[model samples]
Target: MAPRFTVRYFVRAADAAEAKARALDIALEQTVEIPRDVVPKGYVEDEILGRLETLEQAPDGRPGFLATISYSEDDVGGDFLQFLNIVFGNSSIKPGLKVEDIGLSPGILSLCKGPRHGITGLRARAGIGDIPLLMSAIKPVGLSTAALARLAHDFALGGMHYVKDDHGLVDQRTAPFSERLKACVEAVGEANAKSGGRTSFVPNITGPADAILERAKEAEAAGAGAVMIAPALAGYDVARMLAADPDFSLPIVAHPAFSGANVVSPDCGFSHRAFYGVLHRLMGADAVVFPNFGGRFGFTREECRSIAEACAVEMGGPKAGVPAPGGGVNFARVPEMRAVYGKDVMYLVGGALLQEPNLIDGCRRLAEAVYA
Candidate 1:
């Protein structure tokens, strides 16, 4: 057997015969993309082609077969994009072929360059130790830099470890990236001075491709503690490229702005854990934001919990990513969230905190609730 990594996909099929046909289709569709009659008999057929290793019925009442197919690392060539392509490229376009798990081979893991500042690193930077962390966003867009800065200040004073820009708050005319980044960083600094907390402003760096690196460097120079990117908006590789850059020191936090479609489907798209947890961790995200269960988003308790588990699973090399679940989260849900996610997660509360009569006090109350 050639050196290869496994990819587990759920193929909708009624019986072994149908399952065998679907699995073979996947093996060829994902690799050669040509007719079986034409697969030349040699290295391409034996080594380069995707090999279906195992096929078993999905557990319990699930209506599919779990097909484990192995693809050679040679096909990847140490390229992250190609790895993604090989994993789900054409297969994603086909219905009833959902990606369940991605098994990284030794060669792939060596190329991973996983989270530079994953969970523990994030805590160290925020001067926090073990205990769930708190994060809030400065939002509603269209606001002036000063107004946004004030919000960052209040959130920091309220003891949020991270105060990030709303994903939509990019370089708008009212709040240009440079102006907003400088003001927010300074405001958070002042708040930290008064509160004796190490809260850091996290500016969103998702924007035009040519300008993202410039913004990241600017954020670092402006003293922002971390930076966020809607990888689904910018590009899947954006986070990975930023995380891999040696000069970029700020921790990378990934936002799920346009990623819902990839996991919301019943029998298509990637699994919640595969997309939000493994993908973000593999992309070097210190933390990943997703819609929490009980939130306005329709994620279930089991789906959310699986994401949390994947974030901290014993990967053994790459440091664990932190799962930050938000969307309609409020004070009433703190205990429930804690029970579901434990201490390894980051509690992200946004609009609810901003709607409070006193933003600072609201944040303080949330921090208190988390600690309790």
Candidate 2:
């Protein structure tokens, strides 16, 4: 038998009989996408079709059954998108099915090299030791390049380990991508000179497919410590390509800009851990950013904790990445955040720092809060 990858799915069905039927439906829908009778026999049916592994009642008390399905490694042909299609593609459109987890075999792991500069590399670049990293965004979108650069300078000087452009800050009339990247990089450099701190600037490089790589290389040329990309917006494989490329050694931060639907549903799309943690890590995200619990977004404490665990958990050979919880995070929540995520996270506090009477002092306070 050929090596296979496993995907655990939550199937919303009332009884065992219905669950069995749904599981069969998933096997067909995810693989051949044809009627069972029409599925060609021999190697096609035996090796290409998804094989049902197990089915049981969901442990979450929901009216569903958890189903595990395995697919041959040849089905992916060493393609990441094909792997995604095998995982959820057509079944994603059907209701009551959520991706719970993915088990990648050694063959699948060899297809894509995970994060190059994962947690350890990122920490070394920032000159930090075992403490939770601090990151803030330069934002409010419409600001000019100079204004954003100033914000980056203050944040870095005040001890923010990584300062990034807001995901929304694309090439607007006020601040083009090149200008913003140049200014922010220079600003952060000046701050590092003054404070003797190893603050790194991260510019959002999410754009057209052709432009994405160009912007990334340009940012690297401009002395950016890292580049942020919304894989959901750009492309998941784009993140993987950047992380896997030896020439572009800068860390890649995975932002959850357009990926809410993948995890917000209780019984659809993907689990928080599978999408933000496992998938992002597999795609070479050095830092995966998601909305924190108690924020404007409706993620629960359990979901948030699960995501954190998945990022750092032992999973074959992929290097562990950082879990960055952001939306609506504030300094007051640092202690609680630390208690929940421990020291392996990157505390992402954005707007809260901007609200401070003095930006630099606010960031200084945030740093103190994280370490204290």
Candidate 3:
């Protein structure tokens, strides 16, 4: 009798009968993980067990069936990880199964509450009204704190809305996190004084589990515009927990590092949209960064669009998140990207801008192109 959320999985099978059996197996496997013959009776069989709501052939011409299995909220117990276990759990280890989409129930939303500063909030933070946002990263991990901070300053002066630390930049000795953060904050503060622009300096907070939340708090205290984290690398729940924490209030920029294996397979792991879009939103990422189409990562235009749409789709109460596509984004592709994502996206470009002799001028021109 409890409320239930649905998970749509693409199951490979030769016939409808086999597909139905596989879906039943998932219902049992994801929930009880026991023999069907002895799955207990009464409450376990009724309320706790997952219900197979629908099963049909994949309309996309794929050789599989889309099976929707709904599970009771009682199975989740208001715990996020438990909820995820019910969503994927042991099911992920088995081949021939792919998580295509997950329905967000009231239980899930009540548990997570999604992003604190979603699309509109990020746009407001950038001091822009109805325009696409610009973001870039300070890269080459071994740079000194002063050098990295200088890149932060120049990026701000060039009209970037948010300048972030490269995901690979960690608490290395050359540019200690504390030292780099302080330098970037100060540098951007100096840039704001001259440019009269509200460019925010974002720092990467991805690190060991015990330290990331501490780093996020430090960044917030240090006047960082936002904090970036590779949720897949730092642990997905880490990002969600920070967003749920009342004491930590900085907007989260999610990076899709080390996530290819979960998505590259044709019939396993997850779809590009499900992994990069829905997962990030659930983890409360204001901006979900991913490998863009026409980029070196080999994501197709359709896959990129699916992610963009998922970021801003109407998902009950949670606010729409912004999709940030990077990985080889350049000036030449701006117009084409704009055509696909419209005015709500944040273009993450660095090498293309840094290649220009005048970093500020290059950024300005990119902004002009975005506006046009």
Candidate 4:
């Protein structure tokens, strides 16, 4: 047997046959020297199979792993995040750890369904190949279905390719998710029919575990183009489950709602790229939405860029996802935003556009700034 390099994931993930098959078939054996103390006592075959191997130690005292895991081709059955969950979603949250060597298995690689609709596919779908896709959101959840749908109609008519419900828009008594979803879908469709444009309506479906999937299914059934969810709000596993569900095929847009606690601690939690980038992609999000630089939330320019890079970067299976740089991106920032995000990005400008003197004109200027 030949020695091979390995990498291990630490988070709680889906440990299914596909993951196991990927590990066995894809990874090659590799020799590594782990610290004497880290390996737990009574190691069994169960532990060795789909277990994290040890390698060198980190300066921070995190035990490194000599990983022997690889993605199976069959593993491409679900969302990218789920793929990662199965690999290392749990381990990332654990206390002691360091990624050791990386092992690639042919099985998982063969099955990996790289981005089904990556930046290129998204642009094609939006009918804007040479420029970034334009997106907006309807928010302040108290609004009725008609009110939100009217906004959706205007945005679609104004040349926005995607219009999603604010992650906050849940199934409130005032504006139930289903009714709002149906109304918005119809509104966008009506606008597209007149304009002959491909406007996609993405409704927020963030809810409890029991209701989340039902909401997603309903949104899809209502002719919605995509469904949005705050994975952290519902459960990190929720996105993966929806992605894997055969009938729930609409692209999932992952939002970082309620996940602020994890990244606030620099030393304890995962790096921003690891969470917003790697983990979100693995969860099966075709497009991962995050707060952009110069936004109210205070994400730095570099951080925003990293998030964008993560969405486009090459992964084990498909091309990376669309980096939806949202949160206070405005018409004025279009030139600067375009310079950073490039044409293969999704420009999400919301509240600012709504506050503008003319919502339609503001959108046009924003689009021009990006396309120009």
Candidate 5:
């Protein structure tokens, strides 16, 4: 009898039935390597030492596994990234191999603080309570800094609570990150002054990995409400670093950009919820953004629900992160989205607001819908 870790796979490989049957046969008969060279050591025996059992079917009829892996604190080697890599490192490549839940021993789980600023903290900052928060994005990436700032002001005036830079809008020559950040923050402040509203302007701080923290600090100094980053693009460790920084404490929003490739395959990669939910929370994202069900993205309705559930579910931490569903959400869809996501969520709508002939009116309509 040895110590074991639990791994719950949400989606199995498309051909997992066959692969799993082979795996089971091998497990019963002899030694088996889970992900070939990725897990040189017996992954089943090493990481999941004691708890290796299979469930009948996932909610979607995908098969799943609950394995008790044997992982050593020594093997973790005192690195969080390494810990994540060791646990889900290799399986991320196999389609349908999503590590749903990691039953870390008390000692291990203790090391993970999830999110420092979660749903409640976010609500407190936004000065809203018990209602779905409405968010918007300043976009198209081609707009000048002044034009983007005007967009931010319009969204804030319209009553949106959070405004973020388009993920694709980075430090382009047309709109340098610093210029865009200053203009947007100032515009939001000006709008707030006139409207007496408290919309949050969250700029995208996805700079070179080394400069991310500096940019985050700069945004805070510029009166920005919160900041966003694509951990997969900038580096997941960078997000953790921002959260851990004592000088800048704005809420961190995690975006899913380069992450699609990680979960698109059925047999390998991390599940959408796991990447956007558990890991984002663990890395200290106050809000985690993902494509919504009805969006152009291929995420299913159940997958969207699972992501929302993961954000709000009790994990015994500061508070649950806000699940911000983005990707073509609009005002007309607010009521329906709210019904599905409920009150304790953040609704992220982009492009639509920008497309509105009257940005302020559009924002107001969205705000009204969310509040209604």
Candidate 6:
């Protein structure tokens, strides 16, 4: 038998028998996608069909049962998307099923390069030890390249360890990607020269598939310290390609722009940790951004903490990633964030800083609060 990977899921049902039935149904629906009896007798049944390993009551006692299913690595065909498809592809559309955890085989790990910079490398790049790294986005779009560059400069000058383009800022006439990339990189460079800080400018590179690699290369040549991409929009494999490429050495920050639907439900799709933490880390995200608790996005405190834990938790060989909790984060929440995430996190503050009368001063104060 070939080496296989395991996926644990919460299967909602009234009884153990029903849960077991549903688990078996998933093994069929996720794989061959046809009637089990009609499945071929040879390789299809022996190698392709998912094997149910266990079916028992859920640990949380949430009116569901825990089901562990194992799949042959051959079924994944050494492809990332196929691996994802095997994990939760067809079954995701059905209700009362949530992916709780994934156990990757060595073959799966070999298929991914994981995080290139990761947490330690990113910390080293920022020249900060164990303290929580500071990051903010330059935004509201519609800003000219020069205007955005000025914001990037101010952010770096004000001591933000990393400055990034807002996810919404793309190749618009107001600020073309190339022009914004060049100007912001230069602006941050100038600020670093004056402040003697190793602040990095991270530009969003999410765009047409053909344009992503070119933009990433351009961003590197333009002196960007890191690059950001919304994997949910650009494609998860694209992020994996950049992370795996030796030429693109800059850190890749994974933004959770269109991934909310994957984790919003209690009994469907993916768990917060699986979608935002483990999966992104596997795809080579140095830092994974998600909506914070108490933010407008409605993520629960437990859900947010679980994501942070997943990023830093031991997962065989993948480098630990930084969990960046943003989306409505503010200066006032620094103490609370510190208490929650400790020093290994990247505090992402955006619009809150823009609300201050002086953007530079607001960022400085924000930095002080974080490092203090």
In candidate 4 the C-alpha lDDT for residue 231 amounts to 78
lDDT of model 1 at residue 49? 89
| Cα lDDT tens digits for candidate 5, 12-31 | 43454754553343232222
Clashing pairs in model 6, backbone N/Cα/C closer than 3 A: none
lDDT (10s digit) by residue, model 2, range 1-372:
679999999999989999999999999999999999999999889999999999999997999999999999988988998999999999999889999999999887987678888888899999999889999999989989999999999999999999999999999999999999999999999999999999999999977778899889999999999999998889879999888787788999999988999988886899999999999999999999999998899998889999999999998988999999999999777878888999999999999999999999999898888888
Candidate 3: lDDT of 359?
Answer: 91
Worst 10 residues of 4 by lDDT: 25-34
- C-alpha-based local distance difference test score of model 3: 0.90
Using lDDT as the measure, the top candidate is: 2
Give a tens-digit lDDT track for model 4, residues 104-149. 4444333344344666666777787666788899877798889889
Residue range 1-372, candidate 6, lDDT tens digits: 778999999999999999999999999999999998899999999988999998889888699999999999999888999999999999999999999999989888888768988999999999989888989999879989998999999999998989999999999999999989889989999999999999999999977879899899889988999999998888879889888887878999999888888999896989998889889999999999998889888998889899999999988888999999998998777888888898889999989988989988998898888888
Model 1 residue 75 CA deviation (Å) reads 0.5
Q: Tens-digit lDDT track for model 1 on 130-222?
A: 989899999879999999999999999999999999998988999988899999999999999998899989999967789988788889988
List per-prediction Cα lDDT, in the order shown. 0.89, 0.92, 0.90, 0.67, 0.74, 0.91
TM-score-wise, the better of 2 and 6 is: 2
Give TM per candidate: 0.98, 0.99, 0.98, 0.76, 0.86, 0.98
Q: How badly does each model clash, as a count of residue pairs?
A: 0, 0, 0, 43, 23, 0
RMSD of each: 1.1, 0.9, 1.0, 7.6, 4.1, 1.0
Where model 4 places Cα greater than 4 Å from the true spot, the runs are 1-114
